[model samples]
Target: MKEDYAFITEQGESTVHELSTVEALIKYQEQFHTGFPLTDKEAEMILGYMEGHDYVLGEVQGNFYQGDLAEVRERICWEEYSMDDVIDAVCEWNYELVLEAEAQRNNPEDFVDFAKSQSRYERLKAEEATLD
Candidate 1:
């Protein structure tokens, strides 16, 4: 029989229904807008990372693994690359995507305009660095 799972929130709340697959988890995230908010791409990226690292679907920190929920949580706590690390990586990836989209939106035709856009992009990066 397939094991059931649930998407738990950082605040200790969980989804109303038990999810059965990676696809269901993604759908819950997209439809409910509860728990840690994630875009479709971000969710897929994080899930992929978990799977690549041998974590079962919904076995990360913010999830419930049926009867093994406590054990799963304990194991995750000791993991070298925990869910937080994956989340940070995803956030960084999304930020880069945003920056690229912004650059494309401001696409400049002439050399002078290209120089100006480059200068603006640099300035934005510096400001973002300061904020960090």
Candidate 2:
């Protein structure tokens, strides 16, 4: 039988969590800055369930895992590399994507600096929208 897991949020709401381990759960919860507001004993129990088919508080069957995470890459140190290198990295990461196009279209001279903070795909979307 498949082990079941759930995340009870601070708002008295619960959701399915397929990644059973507390470490992965913690990482998942932390992604939204929505740390589980559980007691130490409850937290330990959640972690304990990682062993095998175990139970905690909430469990709902036939439910998809509610904690899918987006890729969130951090910004690289601008001072660590020369202007040329950063642009190269950004272009390589973008791969003819909108970041390269937007940067080139709006700020070619400072394209490296412009793309510096916009590392993740989600952030790139926001940056592009704001640029318009």
Candidate 3:
């Protein structure tokens, strides 16, 4: 089953995690600058659920896992990699995606203006005006 994990960074950024077992989670927490909010006992219970899984070696404090958005996205859905790798990959993937999303969000007026210039939006506007 796909485990839905969540990582909340010190900056109040929250991202969804897709790791399978507790061991993977521990491994991931060990590598990253951010620590898991879970206690050791809780982490152990998670480890119990993950009996056999493979993990990729990733440095927690470095950008080794950065910019490989495609690979990261694929790893999130993969079962072969341990939960830590999955979380690391997914977090890295989302870091980039979030940047892009934030950029787009900050420029909504640009999209709105672009949409207004499109014939589709013009047509819709005219239709809506007529309904008034």
Candidate 4:
């Protein structure tokens, strides 16, 4: 599952706001001017780029599963992993996604292999489990 976040500032204070992925995408386009009517691949790339950053905008942050990691683990019955492990996994996964997106963006002939990406992500999780 994918999650989205935005940063909103009011009265000299900033807070992270969780929103649906579609809403986040729209906000992203509005802020970045990447263009309207983004294609699926383009949207994926934008999400990847967004998640790769610590702050999407001033005082606003973006990261995969930023505030919902615990719920996500519980929903998926990932009882064996610690919160820190989950955080690491999410960070690594986002980094990999961003790298893949950048690579594909730079090389038009190159295509993203979701199967490979999933396999690698699972392997990372397995490795993290074994480290415990």
Better candidate by TM-score, 2 or 4: 4
| Candidate 1 displacement at residue 15 in angstroms | 14
Q: Report RMSD for candidate 1.
A: 11.4
Model 3 stretches astray by more than 4 angstroms: 1-79, 110-132
Summarize candidate 1's per-residue lDDT along 1-132 as a digit string, tens digits: 244333345566443333334576666555644456555545555555445444544433333332222455544222223335556654465467458746754887777877776776675565345323
Clashing pairs in 1: none
* Candidate of highest TM-score: 1
TM-score of each: 0.31, 0.21, 0.26, 0.26
Q: Which stretches in model 4 have alpha-carbon errors above 4 Å?
A: 1-78, 109-132
lDDT of 4 by residue, 1-132 (tens): 333233333444344444235455556446645334444544444344334542221113332223333334433111222224433554565556556654545555423565555555565445334333
Q: Candidate 2's C-alpha lDDT?
A: 0.37
Give candidate 4's total backbone clashes: 0
What overall lDDT, based on C-alpha atoms, would model 1 receive against the true structure? 0.49
| Alpha-carbon runs more than 4 Å astray in model 2 | 1-17, 35-42, 47-132
Kindly give the stretch of ten consecutive residues in candidate 3 with the minimal lDDT sum.
60-69
Whole-model lDDT values for every prediction: 0.49, 0.37, 0.40, 0.41
